[model samples]
Target chain A: MSPRRGTRRLRLSDPHRRVRFGLAVVLTVLTIIGGRLVQLQGLDGMKYAAAAEELRLTRLDLPAARGQILDRDGNALAYSVEARAIFADPGMIVAPGRTALALAPLLATSADALMGELTADGRFVYLARGLDPAGAQAIMDLQLAGIGELVEQRREYPAEWTAAQVVGFVGQDDTGLAGIEDQYDDVLTGTPGQLVYEQGRFGLPIPAATHSLEEAVPGSDVQLTLDQDLQFTLEQALAVANENAGVSSAQAVVLDVATGQVLAMGGSPGYNAADPGGVRGDQLANPTVSHVIEPGSVNKMITFAGALEEGLITPETELTVPDNIAVSDIVINDAWGHAPIHFTATGILGKSSNVGTVMLAQQLGNARLEEYLRRFGLGTATGIELPAESNGILLPHEEWSGSQAGTIPFGQGVSMTVLQMASMFQAVANDGVLVPPRIVDQVIGPDGTVIDQPGSEPRRVLEPDTSADLRYMLESVTNEGGTAPLARIDGYRVAGKTGTAQRPNPECRCYAGGGYWATFAGFAPADDPRYVIAISVEQPGGSGGGGVIAAPVFTSIMSFALGDNGVAPTGTPSPEFRLTTDED
Target chain B: MSALPAYDRPQRVAGRRTEPTRVSLQRPVAAPAPAGRAPFVALILFVIGAGLIALLVLNTAIAADSFTERSLSQQIEQLRLQEQELQQEIGAAQAPAALARAAVEQGMVPAGPPGFLIVHPDGTTQVVGEAKPATRPPPPARRN
Candidate 1:
């Protein structure tokens, strides 16, 4: 047989092998296709879908306004107003030097300064921070290419320095920096809104087809316990005190006796919270709470209150006061040299007798006396919710020396914040209860609902009958021959105390030469106390004390506050007192 | 058990092969009546399965979209609140009352009755609070 014929016959005979080869190829192709289908449908499908959705959608946030600060009468003490500021897109400016030159005159800036700002590498640069409408408009009218006003917000102060320190100010970025602005920042800042839009292929939003949009939630408004008219009156009185006494610093605080609410707080030479550049160094400190000094004769009021509270003395109690008395190896003297003068308990307070005060303190003893001072809210911070309140110095009873013993009775050894004085005086005026001072009247939410309401919560500091008796004795402080005669109001029964404490010499451990702090604390309409005012003047020209400086200021503030609050005059004459020979 | 053959007739084995002794293993004489019941059951099953799958896919898509939208809305609201607060602060910082207060603090008292003069177009000026107006002559011009 031929070789070619034999091979052809062999090939034709293996038909089963050919069919198996064809079936194997078909199976391989099907496996590859199935694997790819699984990868697309099961393994990576969600990841791809999310990427596609992200490429088509974009969201942006919008911000809300800060809260408003208003007075009790709903007058805007501090509120927001819109203003324009010119900002430059540095990338867009064609000629930085030329643009700076054109803007310098319009912005009231030097050309060099403008050039420095223009040459900054930032995309957005502030050419001017606070520009008026006319100035902004003028700059815009110049048609300077690349320089334009950015629609950014600026804070506006409607009342400026009227309630400067209380309202506080915001920084250039509109963040609160001090005062109440710093304090309720969270409540004052509102919720931002969202704008969702469809995005194009290159990740830019499609102009017209923005989908879902949400509005911003605005901030709540804050209402204060202060009255604008009463605040103005208090400021005027402080100004008068500063002028008359030539004092470097002075402060006055007025509060409602029944409710611990602060009505007016004023300091001389205050700054505009909106424009902080005009602040002075010495005047920056709030003297009413930040500075501490010896209280002098004002301490006698505390001593008298303690004695009366303990039933140690009454209006008819007779005490024979000499010019000087030696106790605990320390000599105490009256303000005027005189013979053994017979004086009632009422007379002793009226004359502000140093010997009389010591006799009372000695009768009460150390433990009882210290307890009363503590109860009266002395030598400690009043916790009035304002920052930087000084805790005045009070030596522990274990550390009290013989000299401090006699001196403390007439307000020499201890010191207290003006708020503490006002609070303690409120106890006498309020018939026995001492309420914590409140500066915030109410917190209103964005929807005009009151979120937090403040009211007086009184704690009994003295017995009711004792408070009345003390009020009767305090009446003498505003009458003729009293140390605080200037504190009298024509138609009201005012109760007050005067102080002239010598500046303590830390080096010598004794009072220094000619430096004194004058102070007066009082309340009006003794029958039904309405207002309590305390004023302090540092280093007046004369031997400054409550009588010569602080008393007059207190009188003015009290009179104005009473009138503003619609408190009618009592028209009752000052209680008269006569020395009695009989001892109680 | 080889065939006993047709020799043993049906009358002898009546109990065992009652109807037909050997049924032919060939095509049936005629096709039995065609049944329509199976097709109806298959149709009902397909419809129910398709509806359930469609419902699951729709629910998943809606849930994903709603979750994304809610988060985006919350973020936008937060930003809007921040912007409003900033705007209010800016306004308060530049209030008219603040400007007036600043002026007063700088010792620039307001011009009022008894001191400053108000000039009118008739070449006449009046003192504050005064009833009569005074006439003034024009000043000599200055050369640049």
Candidate 2:
């Protein structure tokens, strides 16, 4: 090629050179893409996938509702109500001063305080907690972007004062503060759920995308074993007794003899469950289980049982009742003002002869009497599944002496809780089955599952025949001319004993009239015992004995309870005996 | 050179130019303008990814809130059960039935007002009264 031609060869830089350069650049880009692809697809894929998953799924604990407590007929004694809590996001409050001003009046708080809270740099703060749905809605209507609401649960007692002592109340944190609430809290609470969501830098949710959702679980409902009508009757009767007897307080308890289930348990000066602050500290304690009182002549039932079980006496056994019997230095007397007269063993009970009881106790001796008392569940707690039960004051064998025996036979020198007393009578009423008393029926789980079944054990305490004999004799106490005539119910045969225990004087070591515990314990429809009721009026001024104060109260409560429970009348006549056969 | 008239310098192959235009000159030459559809298409994909993430977050938040609410509700319920049990205990403790039972266990026997046959100065035992009078008629009011 000529130089001129080479020089002048407007070597049109090959036009395809630009194409080749673009190709080179494309090739370089492809290499980079391949390398980056290997890094992401081969190595970072798992990491990024994990990050994506982290944003998608959230695990949540689902909380369940506590159990509902219901009556035997499935009436709601206590239940839960839904409420809402109001909160705020300080950052979102567009105008802190204005928001506070708007919320102050509705929140029932000072505007300045609300402003301080809103203006605080905190991300979140509670403006109001535990507000009802309506209150929450009112706050929401303010349309303050910073405001938030959360739904919660609060407790509600329907029959506010009906079963106040039995239903208990809760604290602000929903913890069981007192009563059944404290005992069954674990069974009523449930697990909660958590949620995980992929959030953007601003934390706002992206619309219409797949996300993990964990639905919350609800708690369980509980059912109780209380009878509302019976409870009401018992409370009213106790109030009346307290008023008429001039007693500081009175209490009544009704139980199903066979089942040991407490049907009605109440006392005078009862506290309301919704507001428990009004209850006095002393009254707050369940006096029946914790307070110890010396049972008066009612203890004679034990003496009579001892005498009958030993075959030492029958209803026809004869004894002479003097106006008074001298036992060493002490003189014992009869409540009935009878002259030295002929009487039978049953007559002794009817007349409530302290000397006769002492004679019976002397025959049994301290060892046998103590053994019987122990067998009857004295000197020990009933273990009734309640908090703070007292074992009652049972004099040790060392404390027992010949003189103590005579005195104890007439109901003195010992103390017992009301529960222990009721349980003992329940034993007799149940035809000798001394089943452990039960307050809680069953514990239910949050998911409506039965968690635990309580009170399934039944213990045979006395022979059926012995119990029947005792019942027959007890009925006479409420008959004409008997000490507790007022205890008799018109349409039903009732068997009961009255106790007018003199409160011992700490100074004189003797009982005084100023402090008397008039007590009545019995079972109704005597032939077929369905309910056993016990009542006592403490320090009933001038009422003197169980017949005057306690027996009438028992009659009132027992009749109402029997009728409320639809108990059929006992068709069989109460067993009777004639004491005229006693030899003089 | 005839000024390379119509086919000058082989017309620079019709695609080749001696220099780029001023408007094109100011344009970044490091890389060609991205395809009109690619970046926008990539942006759409990013938006979809973002939306999915947002949905996941929202669902997670809702689930968590529900769980919290349920847990609080359960707490409230348990508290209620405890309250009921306690209340029942209080009732039982205060029940007169229990009190009476306690009396019986303590060997207590009910005592009624004692009846009396008051003996007068005539040396005869006769029933003087059904109920006792603690204070007599105060000597006929002292005949004031």
Candidate 3:
């Protein structure tokens, strides 16, 4: 069919019409796109950009390094070392048994244990913690697919067994477990930080992406008042005493009499701090602050001091004493059998006469005796900066049994720690002032600012004159015929007491046979005491006398301590004291 | 009208004479003044392009520095670890047991009772308690 007239005329006969229509369509589309572009790019750009950046950002936690424990001379007793912990993504690990076998030797773990950890139903699991750098690096070099490493701090005690009880140890999670570590945990642990940055698709950080870091703050360093040299000496002495006396355990503590700082404190059979896993739980406790034993004749010093303070007796007061005194169905005797004799207070203490001491305690009575015991820091924790300290056992005057008055006077019914016993003598050595023993001396902050730990204030327990008289009387105990003549240090006037008390049987609440606590508490240069040493030997196998077993240990430790610290001896001669009375 | 003189009539070309031969009157239109060179706009565009290129280079440099910074940080961490390890070694060496063992290996023994030299205010020095040397010498050197 022929085309219609209008269609033939309109259809492409004029090319300009087609071009004009195309231009108009192109312009209309461009106008629509330009309007939308203005709305998006100029008005809503920031929000979209922020959302895009947010999807790419990641936050990482930064761990802080734990603090170090230093000795008085800046020796690192305990410190945190950098280490790596190995962890596994159990779901990602293939052949858990094979992987465990491969990692066993490097991790120092058994294959079965590692396999158990690996086959556990969890996304993430720790295979090993606190591995050394070399060991962790070796495992990392294995290129195990699911294994990864995290940097962590491992606590280390370089001195090993030296002062182990005081420095303590940390657990696998870097938490303090005992000793000063547990006591000062908050101060030792630092604040962790955060790292915020953009990461790419494969979890790698995007280069030039926004990054913000809040740096981790390291913990402060704690300085203890312990002198490591003296600590070594004390430990050695205790070890030797234990071996020589065939005792179950031995303990010794040396304190700076003036400052009440624990210069050295230790017990034999100490556990290694680095390898605490195999140690007994009881061995981990610091026995110097925890173990309580009857103070024996050492408690007589308190009785005499109480008597002297109350003006009930003088160093020259004469008394007619018998070999044994019977009081309320119990008979107390001197450590050695002696006749009824005239004795002065000094002679009584020198001889360690239980009869003489009970006579003096009878004059002071139970009320005054209990008050003096409490005043000397008994029946309460000394508030030292150590964990698991015992308050010791000091029964009230009303709680005493009929025979307790007699036995307690001679130190049978009372008990105290070696540290408390040392502190008691410290009061006498420090001129009638009782200063609480302190282990920590200073804490240095991360920014190099030092905070000195103020020691506990001294409390007056006795008059200066009373302490002087006590010192004079105690010196006679180490004199020529005194009970602890072996405790005498040549060229120095020594003042101390000897104590030998039978150990109480746990099964039956009575004194056990052939088990005695031999103890000696004293200070050297008696005229001007510098250091106080207290030594206790438990259950000396043969002749368990404090004078025979504990006194020599004190002499050795005191001599070394004085010599090491360069304390000069007092040149004045010790005054003469009569052990045998003229009326006898 | 009357017949005009042939000399005064306008001249026409041959082909258009068939339709009404219209005389075309034309006035000379001045050509537009040559457009001034827009060098300022060109210079601005050039500056913008150059700035974009400079920014691209600077951004690449910063990215490269970030990688370098990461590498340096890693190296610093390694050095810190090494420092701690060396400190651990020193601490081990200085431990009392190690020192005592070393001293024993070197023909030395623990000190005996230490004597003191007292310096009097009057310039007289007195030695108290004779300082005895440790009689036990170190064990004979190991042959192996």
- Clash count of each predicted structure: 45, 70, 0
lDDT score of model 3?
A: 0.86
Q: Which candidate comes out best when scored by TM-score?
A: 3
User: How is the predicted docking of candidate 1 categorized under the CAPRI scheme?
Assistant: incorrect
If both were scored by lDDT, which would come out higher, candidate 1 or candidate 3? 3
Docking class of 3: acceptable
C-alpha lDDT (0 to 100) for residue A264 of candidate 1: 81
Where does model 2 exceed 4 Å of error?
Answer: A1-62, A87-129, A143-148, A199-217, A325-330, A401-403, A451-456, A504-514, A540-544, A579-584, B1-144
TM-score of each prediction: 0.71, 0.69, 0.86
Q: After superposition, how far is residue A282 of candidate 2 from its true place, in Å?
A: 3.6
**Candidate 2, A363-434: lDDT as tens digits:** 887888887787788898888755677898778767775566676776677788777778888988888888
User: Tens digit of lDDT per residue, candidate 1, span A1-584?
Assistant: 68988987887578886678677888888888888888877898888877777668787765576788887877767655445679888888899888888888888889999888787897888788666555687899988777887544456665566667677778877777666676767777778787788876554445445478898787888888888767766766666666664476677788888788888886776776657767765554456677777778888888898899899999879898888999788788888898887889988998889998898999998788888888877777776656677888888877899888888888887988777778889888988888877787888898889987546566787999989988888878777667787887756788888888787555677665546778898898878899998877777345666897899898767866765555665545666755434333
In lDDT terms, which candidate is top?
3
TM-score (0 to 1) for chain B of model 2: 0.38
Error of 3 at A396 (Å): 1.6
lDDT digits (tens) for residues B24-108 of candidate 3: 4442233332356246546766888899999999988877776787789889977877887899899999987777778877768
Lowest summed lDDT window (length 10), candidate 1 chain A = A575-584
